[model samples]
Target: MTRNTDDDGIVVLGHPRSGTTLLRRLINLHPNISSPPETHLLSACARFLDADMTADGVDMGVLAGLDFSGFSESDVLKELRQFSFGFLQRIAERKGKARWAEKTAFDIFHLKNIEKLCEDHVYYVAIVRHPLDVAVSCTEFCTSMGTYPSTLHEYIKRYPQPIEAFAMSWLETTKALMDLGRKRSSRFIMVRYEDIIEDENEIMNSVFQFVDEEHGCDQAQSIFNSIPEIGFSDHKSLQEKSIHKKSIDRWRSLPSPQVKRLGELLNPLLAELGYDEIENTGEIGTTAARRRYATSLALHAAKTNETDDDTKD
Candidate 1:
C-alpha cells in the first residue's frame, strides 16, 4: 500500500451514466492511487480559453455563453492543451494523491482533447455499456424519466434513435482510444462496464497489475478494502458504488416493440463492439421499457419538500 512519488495518472472515460463513476471508485480502491470525486475536470479545463474557469467547478453561466461549434482551430487546441494540463497538474498536486486519476463521462465526447491531456505520463481506462441501457438511462437523465423512443417511424421525422446514437458514440470513442493505443502501444488500456459489474475483484486485480506495471506502485487488496464503501444516497454517490446489487441489464423485461426497435437501432454498433445484433422480432414500436435508477434519497427529498408545503398550508 505504499505510495509512489512518480505520480502517474489515468483518465476514465465513457458517456454520462455509462459507469465512469463506478470505474473511478474501483480504481481509487487501489492503495497507491487516488481519484477525488467524479471530477469533470477534463472538459472544464480544456475549454478554459473561452471558459471562466473556477477552482474546480465549471460555471454554468460561462458554459451557456457559447455553442460547441464555436471551438477554435488546431492552433487553439495546442494552446488549450498546455493550459489544461497545467491546471490539472496543480489540481492533482493539491489532492495529495501521488498517482492521480480523473473521471468524466462526457470526456469521451471530447476524445481529441482528452488524448492531449493524458499524453504526458498518464493512462486511460475506457468503459462501454450496452447502447439500449445508455439510452434508457439518458432518457431519465434528460427528462427525469424514461420517455424516449427506440425506433424511427415513417412520417415521424425519421430522427436518429437515441439508443443508436449512444451505441455509435460508444463505439467511435473507444475505437479512437484503441487506435491511439495501437500507435503508442505502451500508454492505454480498455475495459468494459459489464466486466466490472460481473466480477469486480477480477477486474480490479487486472487494473492493479496494469497500474503497478506502468508505475512502480506496490499495491494490495488491504489498501483497496480501505477505500470506503459509500452508498448511492444522491447523485453524488454514483461515483461510489451504490450499496445495492443493481443488475446491469433491465431491457429484458421491456416490451417487444421497444426491444426490437432498440435492436434495430443498435445493430451496427453491436456488431462493431463484438456484440451480437438481435433480429427485429416483428414487435418494433412498444413502450414498456423505462428507466428507474435514481437514488431513493432524491425521491425522498422531493416528497419531503411536497409534505412541507402541505404542512404550511
Candidate 2:
C-alpha cells in the first residue's frame, strides 16, 4: 500500500514538565517517524494571523493595505493549509521517514486553529500529569534555572505561586485541550505521566493504537535504555538514564505546608483528572517528612563542606 506520509503528522502537547518531551523522544525512535525539537510552527502562524483572522474568517481589511483582494478568504486559507501540510511533509521526507511528530505545549491553545487548517490529517496526544507533581517539578525547574522567586509572596508578585498557580494552570490548560479532543475523540488521546513511568510499553502501545498502527514495543523499550542528556534547549539536562520511581509522587518530598496547600487547591481538579483526592488532614504527618528533608539537606551541606576542606588540604 502506498503511504500517505503527509497525513501522518502527530502532535504531542501538554504543559511543560508533563513528560511531553520524553514521549516525543520515544516516538521519534520509531524507524518510521522522527521529530525535531518543537518548531512551534502552528502556534506562531496562528499568532501572526491574529485572533480576529481565523481560517474561515480572515478579514482582508486587517492585512493593513496588502493586496488580499486578489484572493478570497477561502483561497488564502486553502493556501495556508497547503503550506502547513507541506512543512510537515518536507521535514519527514528530509529525515527519510514516513511520519513526523511535533511537540510544543504552546500548541495546546491553538489546536482548534491547527485542526481548521490541517483537518483530519493531524493526530493529537495530550500528556497529563498529577497537578501536584507538575507544580513541584515546575517550581524546582524554575529554581534550578535561577528564575523562581524564593518566597511565596515574591513569587506571586512576579509570577503565580507554585503549587496553587501551577496546578490551576495545568487544570485549565488540560481541560481546555481535552474539550477540543472530545469533539474529535478518534484522533486524540490523553496519556498520564504516571502510567508511562509505570509501564512505558503499555502506554506507548496505546498511543500507537490511537494512531491506527501496530505496537512498537521493541522500539519503545530500546529508546528507554539510555536517555541522552538532552536539555530543554540544552541548559536543563536529564542526567539520568533510567526513569526513576522517584519521578512519581514528587510532591511527597515537598514541605508539609506546601503539600497541604496544593492538596487543598488541587483536589477538585485532581479528582477531575482521575487522581485520588488528597486527604485533607492538616499537617498530621508533617514532622517525619520534614525531618527526612532536613536530614537530607544537612547531609548535602556536610558533603559540600567536606569537599571544600579536602580541596584545601
Candidate 3:
C-alpha cells in the first residue's frame, strides 16, 4: 500500500508518571489532533521481530515459515509498518480528526523501531518531570496501589532501595529520549512537566508548532473536559480538570535521608535537565508533608516487607 507521509502522526514518549497523559490530553484538545491512549504497538512489533525463540526454547518459527512461503523479512516488516499507521489513521478518521498522537509509557525504549516504521512521518514529544518527584510518585503507586509490581520487583532486585530504582529508571529513560531529541531535533521536542504547569500557553504553543498543528492554548483550560477512557494512563490526571503545581516539588516532603540518597544518584542528570540540585537538609517538613511521607514509607514496607530504617534521617 502506498503511504502518505504528509499525514503526520505524533508519538509521546516519557517515563511512567512523567505527565505524558496530561500532555496527551492537552494535545487532544486541538481540533485537528486525536491523542489516543497507551497502545504499545511499536514495542509489540519490535519484540516480534527481535524474538528468536519462545519461553520454552522453541524457535518462534514465524519468520522461517514466511521465508518458506516466499516472503522476505523486509516484506513482513513493511506490511507491519503500514498496518501500524493504518490502524492509528483509521481511529483519527473516526474521531473526525486530521492527525493522531499516541502515548505509551514504555514507548521511549522502542524509538529505533518506531523511527524505522514511520521515518519522517512521525513527530516525537518527550515530556519529563523532576526525577525525585517521579521516583516519589512511582514508589507511591507501586507500594500503595500495586501498580507495576513486576517492574518494581525487578528494580528492587537490582538496587538496594526503591527510590534508587525509580530514580535510575527516570535517569535511563530520560537520557535515551534526550539523546534522540538531540539526534532528531527537527522532529523531536522535549517538554518539562513543571514548565507546562507554570506556563501552559507558551509551552503548549511551542508543542503545537513543533507538530505543525494550529495552537489551541485558548482551550487548554478545558482540555480535561473530554479525558480519554484509557485504562492504563495516569488515573489521577483524568480526575484533574486543569493543570496545577500541587505535585511540583513533592519530593521536598520526603524524609531527608531518602532525599539525600536520591540526590546522590540523580544530581548529575538533574543538572543536565536544567532542574535545581536536590538539597537534603535534615529539616522537618509540614505536618501534611510528613504524614504523606510516612504513609508512603508504610506502604512500601508493607508491600515489600522491608524495614523503613533507610527512610529515617
Candidate 4:
C-alpha cells in the first residue's frame, strides 16, 4: 500500500446534501482508498485568499483587517498545499491504502484553486443531484436543524423553499466543475447522484477504474462489491443507513404550484438533467411579492452563513 511522495489523490465534491458524504463512505470501504471527514482545506484556502485581497480594504470585515505577520500569499498557499498532501497521505498510509480521497461540499466553489494547489496529483469526481430532490432534502434537513424558513413565501425567498436557489447553485456548480473536467479530461470525472443510487455497481466500478487508471493500479471490482449496506445521519438527523430507492421521485409529491415555479425558474437546467419541466410561464406576479422574495433571499443567505460559522465552531 506504499505510495510515492507524488501519488495522485482523489477529491469528491458536490452541492451540499447531494450525496457527497455517501460517496465518501462508499469509496472508503474499498481497501485501496482512504476517505476521511471533510478537511475543508480547499474551501478554507479559497476563503483566506479571497479575504486577504480586498478592493476597498473591507471585504470580510475583520478578516480583511487582520494581518499575517510575515507570510506572503504564496507562502500561505504553498503551506496549505503541503498540509493537504501531508494530511491525506498519512491517513491513507495508516489505513494501509495506496490512495486517498477528500470530500467537502464547500469545495464546489474552489475547483480551480484546488487544481492549482494539488498540481498534477489531484483527480476530481463531482456528483450532481436533481434540483427538486436537492431542494426537498435541503428543506427537510434545514428545518430539522432549526434553520428552515418560516412560510411558503419565506421559503420562496430563501433556500430550503423557493427552491430556485438550489437550482441555481446546482446548475452553477455542476456547469463550472464539468467545464473544468472537460478541460482537464483525464484528471476529472462527473457522476450523477441518481446514477449511483440506481446503478451503484456500475457507477462505482467506473469510479474505481478511473482511480486505478490515474494511479497506475489494476483495482479489483470485488472490493466495491464487498462493501456492506452503508448509512449516514444527515444534518437533520435523518438516517440514510442503507441505500434505497425511496427518495428517487420524492419531488413528484410537491404541490403543483411549487413544482411549476421551480420549473419556471430552472427549466433549461432541469431539462438538461433529464427532469420534466413546465414550459409555460406568466404566474406569481406582484411588486410586494417581488420585494418580499428578494428580502427573503437576502435573509436566507445571511442565515446560511451564520449556520456555517456555527458549524465551524
| lDDT assessment of candidate 4 | 0.68
Let me know the TM-score candidate 2 reaches against the reference structure: 0.74
Candidate 1: segments with Cα more than 4 A from true spot: 1-7, 48-96, 145-178, 181-184, 213-245, 271-274, 283-313
**lDDT digits (tens) for residues 1-313 of candidate 2:** 2336456788787877788877887787767777767777777666555545458875544232243546655555567767765786688788898788887655765655666665666787789898778778777777777674332234345445666666766766777777868786767788888888888888888888777677764555454475553433322324445555777887777666666766887788678778898876576565887787899999999999999999999
Best prediction by TM-score: 3
Cα lDDT of model 3 by residue, 77-170, tens digit? 7788778877878888899998889887767666666665655567888899998888888888777686665545667789867778888888
State, as a TM-score between 0 and 1, how close model 1 is to the true structure: 0.61
Model with the higher lDDT, candidate 2 or 4: 2
lDDT per residue for candidate 4 within 1-313, as digits (tens), equals: 2334465788898877788876776787777778876777667665555544457665552223343455554555567777877888897898799778988766876766676566556777878887778877766766666654332224346554446666566667777877777777876777888888887767887887776633222332333345332332343312344566777777777656567776766778667766566555345557856777799999999999999999999
Better of 2 and 3 by lDDT: 3
- Candidate 1 per-residue lDDT, tens place, 1-313, comes to 3334343567776766677776776666554566656455676655553435578876443233443446434445555555554555565566564567777666665666566544644666767777667656664564653343222112123336554455455455656766766765565666667776667666766776766643222242332345453432115334333423364666566556656766766687678666568667784222422222245567889999999999999
Measured by lDDT, the strongest candidate is 3
State how far residue 280 of model 1 sits from its true place (Å).
3.4
Model 4, which residues run further than 4 Å from truth?
1-7, 52-76, 148-162, 213-238, 274-313
> What residue runs in model 3 are displaced by over 4 Å at the alpha carbon?
1-7, 52-74, 147-152, 227-231, 280-313
Error of 2 at 69 (Å): 3.1
